[model samples]
Target: MPAPPSAAASTTNSTATLDDDEDELNDLRVAIAQLISLPQAGSEVKEKGRAALHGTVEDMRAFLDTGYRLAQAQDDRVALAQLHSKPDTSPELKTAVRAILRTSDPEEMRWFLEVGQYEVDQ
Candidate 1:
């Protein structure tokens, strides 16, 4: 077999791994920041983003993987309910909201809240 790695080589490998981990963490931080900055991001999304920023790497990954979508969906539902309750909301918008609710798809609801609602209003 080949000779074992020297102490210097082992240290270099460890340092490289650390650098990679730091880069990943930095990327995750930037992603969370971007999510928090979104105009369409609701309170739940913002709150979760903030939490993930202050949490561990796993927390950030969890937020990006699942938490963000779930929080966005919750916020979307709340927004739809608020819009439905509003007296001045247009009939077309209300109808669109009803149709979105019927679908029960979080992604569809999120899309309606983000873009489809404006299209319907216009």
Candidate 2:
């Protein structure tokens, strides 16, 4: 197996850490207590002071599709994981993701991006 999905992952908090008693977790817990005791990540979203207009869906689509082109070798596991985690984007976004998943060939997906529904505002 792939080393038991080691807690030693590339991205922060991307995987479940094995050491529940680790100093980092304790420190994080304390820090979290302090933070929650304050506001922001602790406070509810409705309590946020100021927020601006969100980015366009097109922009988000482009950002998600960055780096690799269709059929060019991409991490399906990572993509699936991300999609599975986010249960609150949009129906259209989810459709796009599902469409991408439906594509068996990555190269074909790339073509779709190049000359398909992958429309990004300039």
Candidate 3:
């Protein structure tokens, strides 16, 4: 039988980095903290925020489920950047991406933008 991979090779082949998972986990924590900190966020905002937080958690699970090595998932952010840079893109798409890039908090805002469920006021 062929020899097993060397320790160095095996370590290098790990598809997910601890730093990445930690950062995503930290994001979830921050999102949760916001709800606690801002008691006046209102029922509608709270509902949206909770859903967004749930989505972020699910996204992490989905990423882990894919062996964390799928090129497409890794490439999505890059693609988003490329599309945002292209002036020829449709107005609606550009508006949506701009909304996503606006803030790292309130993940629901980004989801709404991505799904075209909410329009960003100029």
The whole-model lDDT of each prediction reads 0.91, 0.40, 0.52
Expressed as tens digits, the lDDT of each residue in 1-122 for candidate 1 is 99999999999999999999999999999999999898878899999999999999999999999999888888888889898879999998899899898887898998887789889877
lDDT, candidate 1, equals: 0.91
lDDT ranking, best first: 1, 3, 2
For all candidates, what are the clash counts?
Answer: 0, 4, 0
Residue 116 lDDT in candidate 2 = 43
Regions of model 3 farther than 4 Å from truth? 1-6, 9-16, 57-122
- TM-score of candidate 1 to 2 decimals: 0.87
Q: Cα deviation in Å at residue 49, candidate 3?
A: 1.4
Q: For model 3, how does the per-residue alpha-carbon lDDT over 20-72 read when each residue is reduced to its tens digit?
A: 77787887657554643463344444445455456667754443344232322
Candidate 2: residue 102 Cα off by (Å): 0.9
Off by over 4 Å in 1: 119-122
Worst 10 residues of 1 by lDDT: 113-122
Ranking of predictions according to TM-score: 1, 3, 2
Q: Write the per-residue lDDT of candidate 2 for residues 1-122, one digit (tens) a residue.
A: 45555455544454335453354445544433343243212123212111111333343233224422221334443343365457764566556656776765666444444444335221
